[model samples]
Target: MKSERLELSTNDVKLADQILESMPGFSEKMLQITQRLLNRERQHGRYIVRDQLARGGMGVIYTVYDQDLRRTTAMKVLPPQILHQEPKVSSFIEESRITAQLEHPNIVPIHEIGVIEGSSLPYYTMKLIDGEPLTNVIRMVAREDPDYVRHYTRHRLLDIFLKVCNAVAYAHSHGVIHRDIKPENIMVGKFGEVLLMDWGLAKYVDADDNTAFEEAQDSSQIIEHNPSRTEDGVIKGSLAYIAPEQVLGEPSAIDKKTDIFLLGGTLYQIFTHLPPYEGENMIDVLQRAERCQYEVPSKRNPRAQIPKAVERIILHAMAPTKDKRYASCQDLIDDVEAFLAGRRSGGIRQFRVGQEIIKAGDKSKETFVIISGKAKIHRSVNGRNMTIAEIGAGEIVGEMAGIGQGARTATVTATEDTETLIITYELMLDELRKLPPWMEKIVFSLADRVRINSGYLHPLLLENRIFPLVNQLFLIYAGAHVQAEPDTPISYPLKDVVNEVTMNLGLDMASTTKVIDILAEEGLCVNVAEQLSIPSLQDFALFNDYCRCKMDINTGVKKIKEIQLTKEKDSCFRQIVRHLHEIDV
Candidate 1:
């Protein structure tokens, strides 16, 4: 069998393109064959355009194979259909240059910028992310897909939001403002990579530019419900998420704060499953955005269970007046990070007397900050609910479970009508994650000691035993290796480590050695071959923090009787006024 290969010369390829263009009403089958052949023959420098991935207002994107690098990447090419348009070409070039300059993990990296050898089709290749737009994820969440709901938890969304914030902060630091930030422009990769896409509408802080072709320049092809297309004098961003200043169409009004507003809108959609601004028509939507009129996420979607701290952050970032909003992305990041860390001053709740605030053995993680009134701690000691201690305003309860220490160790019931602020489990975990490795082990150690027995050692001896010992142990572990990997253990001399801890705490070696055994039992450290080895430095650090917290609770419970009360009069007054209003008095 003779296999013969037929190759076309330059003239044959040119003639085929001419015939395909000139032929009128060609059969669909023949057209498909001809197009496939033409596409195979076409090459953009080292890239062979395989198929059109998407068609956007500015240009078309194609899945391209790079012959030089022997890899697949996405190529955005300014379509020949609009090559004659000067503004479109300029915007395309600007987008490539700007995106290339901003080297960040969260921003798509541009690899090569060039033009097709025989045509004026300018293109740029970028890393092809194996992901879907955040808008798609938001849709799945909106429809309540079980898997999506479980995977895209509020905490996960906030994590993604923070990454986008970092990208925006980087852009701002480089004196660039992303004028068109929306869910559509965010890509959530398969392996938890969050990327902020589309920078065509980005502008330099000092430039005065009218974006008549801004939306067209954006790489997102998904036409939103009502994209605010810019004319000679009109808005230049997605209508639903643009800042109020964007609605004014003043070039000077668009700045870093505008990006903050867009971020708030994205976050609002994340929690509420809908954009902040909505109306019956485009005009109405524009009017709402212009006035910054929108319900807080909870009000917009009660079932979303949006947290109070998150709502405050959204409102503060989306304030109608620029001056009222967060001054910078870093400021916005601080508030959001604080909320995630469970450092928020939560909303107040009133509990009736005799109400059980926490039940022993229950796996709950809410920590209650006492605002007013008193609570009694009770533990079931040998099948009897024995009163352990009394707590008043300025105290906290349920912290053991809050720090991921498993089940509640005791029961708490209000001795009198009580007021409290609650920290949720999710926020508690977020806060716990931020703890330094050393602090984490301290906490775990203290928690284990308390769990071992509320009255393990004499209170005086226990105080001296845990704190100084744990602190000294941490200093040795951290000082040994600053950058040790979690899975790899760090070894220190057992005798020396023990001597250091006991001498610092002024405690006997036997008591301090017992503490190390407990930590080992808790899977925090290992004692082997006369060496003190911390299997996971991170885990050891977590235990350290847990021990410290338990110490505070133990000592604080003892001194509750001696503490003086300083009431918040304004809070009481506000409650009274609210009660009167409810009763119409």
Candidate 2:
């Protein structure tokens, strides 16, 4: 078999230069790596390399079309110099083996692995994603759309980082640690797709306890490179994104936090368009990374104006010690989501309006509450407009749509400059579960109010009197029972009862009051302490049943009279039934 050769292009050189220029301290190293990649392309005739996708210390990535597969694929080939080193070659093989086991959407999917014929050099092909490196994208956005980047309020940057965390977290769960995570390794596609690339330095921390043959293989490779000495070792990762533990040459000591540190460094670069530290030599860079001393992300990019939540995420992820950082990538993901939801280390937030609020049908990612302004709720019906209810301050809207309900029950818009407490479904459920008993009660109460208002107004919109004053009176009486004390007389002020009936039942307060007064004058009700109640115990029982049955007021009065007459025959049963009804109702 002969080694396959491919041709390189001027555009590839230019792309390599652009990447190197953007990564200031790594310019010389990247250029050297790119030259080696070009040399490899000239040597291998099979892979039709189109453009350089990325350049790193270990290798150069190219977007190539696989003639057999008939689809574009990303090919990462190690440079001859690195491949010639036994340790580096072994590490590359180990990474390829480990990554092949990982199957996730956010991770760049590996297709196949092949070795250049007549040589020990290995290369792997993966799905070729059409996207910009997050590093370049962030830098472009920072320079051109600083305002949008800083104050867009969408936290799109955080969302992308979270997806990266999810991928790394998944890798961690599978016992693989991405030793090198930098901005250039993350790809952001046109349709908000994020792919984490470059698992070349990924290590299986648990592979140590495997078979003796595997241990011998790894040990032999390490011995060949004599990596025990600081400068003699293969240095398997890029200096900039290397974790402090890795810089200390204690690769075994590096754990999940190492990934966290790298992710934090990536975030730092994304926001500032600069690595945390810049130095002339790898030693200085490694020393600074080991020391973990750098200006805060906010200070580095004054225009970035990062939220405290985001700053905290970087700080925690980049904690100097493993114990200080998050326990896992999932923890970092949680923090990122919390930040995007506008929740940091603070008390639970109440709902507000004017924030990008979404209702049931809205596909938007935000949810909102009506804090201080009024919002009208409407549901579309038969191509006709129907106002369900009017929401005021302290009311929640958009929950139905947000909680996986495919469509919103109604649409809500801010009637004024409302301040809504915004949250995503993920954060909202978390916060809701942690709420105090009183908060739960308040939320349910608001929901009930919305339901009641919607039902009442829906009929009104159709010009149909669905709930008359008699029906409204029964609902008020039933509602009062829940709040009333057992064996205690519950009273409603004449004016209050009248107002409730008129507003909810679409009747005049005067008409409502007149009906109530007639009942009192007939000895069916009593006025005690300026509050209305049933005078006779039997009458109260009859009224309770009538209210529960949804009968007309006049019919309910007649039923009460019939019950009173029947009670005249059995005194004890009537008294007991009346008392039981009063307590239960």
Candidate 3:
């Protein structure tokens, strides 16, 4: 005996739906029955549904067998109840079309797209990937499973991130933006194949396609239910990882940077074992997303030992504003690859004593970090060079000029043999661009202040004005030391010298120390082990006379004195006075 398949006509199905709607449970049961009858009737174009593989907000993925092609495949289809809804139908069809257009290896290939026979429901068959979603792998790693912990090292996770970047980059090249990028949508195959799944929220920027799903306003719709996946006609993306613009519901803000933000969020989860945003519920998470409020990856999970370079990349990509984010996936890829390769954009420079590291009025956009030794910052005022500040190892210089993007405001010279890291403007801009808009504005303002303050009275003049007290203190101590030899340095306890200067001149220890440091820099005094040593009392006396001469010239006090000295002493004194006279004090 031959079996007969029962089929319902279009009107009969509609009448049954209306009748079932009158009863509560009957509607779902009847719809399932009708779906089964339709499947048995036409068998969905020779593809038999085997078992449900996966399900997402948009559709259900089933393990289907192709009778004609004689192979197993994955078929994504919408629930039969939502078939008549136009927005859902349009979104589903667009997703199929977009996925079919992107033919990258990391992106699942669409094998066939067709409507089910005897109905308007649509489905698409894709290559069946033998893999689990990245969400599963992340969970396993988070639990610290012995196998996962040993296998999924930081390097391995980064490799997965790079593969995803390649796919996103390829898609972006074709003018497609994956607005729903996250770990849940990333499928990691058992054999190291990483595929970016679900192009359902992808936007076709090259075309004016308005069929894209709208953003959700209600947080309740997205909570506690696949919070990692985006839904159609509700939330455009997962609340935990969506960009601020996505949470703001501005479709115009969606661009390449938006996808970069999502990629950053995914990378954050890889190391920190938590999404960038977290709260008690979806509303709290959405608020955090809107405000871009989240602890940095380093503070979020210190044990992860997140590399500083990788953390910078994440912060750059997930910048609060889209303008601050990487402009393209390729730009992000370059940074990630650079970090992985242990490369830096900064160059190393070695400067000998008295070599100029930076010259004022020069148009250069490089900032220097002192790696060893010390340098002096000086600026020219009225054709006279004045020392502005002293910078030693582990200090940064020229950043103000770099941030201001203008001519160098001051000159920097190595006082001793020095090494520095020269950071180019391009690299500085790359990192500075990641700052929040307000913070960036503040940084620019500070740079401007530094540049403008060069015209004011310098602090070196104040140090010079207090130079007389140090001279008097030295003279007092030198006279009292009757045991001092002719060429030997006269030593005095540093505290005693500071106290003597402060007691007589009403000066603080810091002021006295500044004067002492100036004398030390000029080689007149040597400081060691809480003791001040004058290398030569003759040289010290000569420098004191030079200070008096400079001060008298500024104060309009005409005083002349005749002095005689040896050739070596005269030469040394003249050289020191010449440098000091450049300050015009």
Best by lDDT: 3
Off by over 4 Å in 2: 1-47, 52-57, 117-120, 145-154, 208-236, 343-585
- lDDT for model 1, please: 0.75
TM-score of every model versus the real structure: 0.55, 0.49, 0.53
Relative to the true structure, how large is the alpha-carbon lDDT of every model?
A: 0.75, 0.64, 0.78
lDDT of 3: 0.78
Candidate 2 residue 7 C-alpha distance from true site, Å: 42
lDDT accuracy of residue 241 in candidate 3: 90
Clashes of 1: 25
The model with the greater lDDT, 1 or 2, is 1
**Residue 330 error, candidate 2, Å:** 1.1
Model 3 agreement with the true structure over 60-126: per-residue lDDT tens digits: 9999988767789999998787887887788788888988899998898999888887777799999
Instruction: Select the stronger candidate by TM-score from 1 and 3.
Output: 1
Error of 1 at 26 (Å): 49
> Which window of ten consecutive residues has the lowest lDDT sum in model 1?
557-566
TM-score of 1: 0.55
Tell me the deviation in Å of residue 488 in model 2: 52
TM-score of 3: 0.53
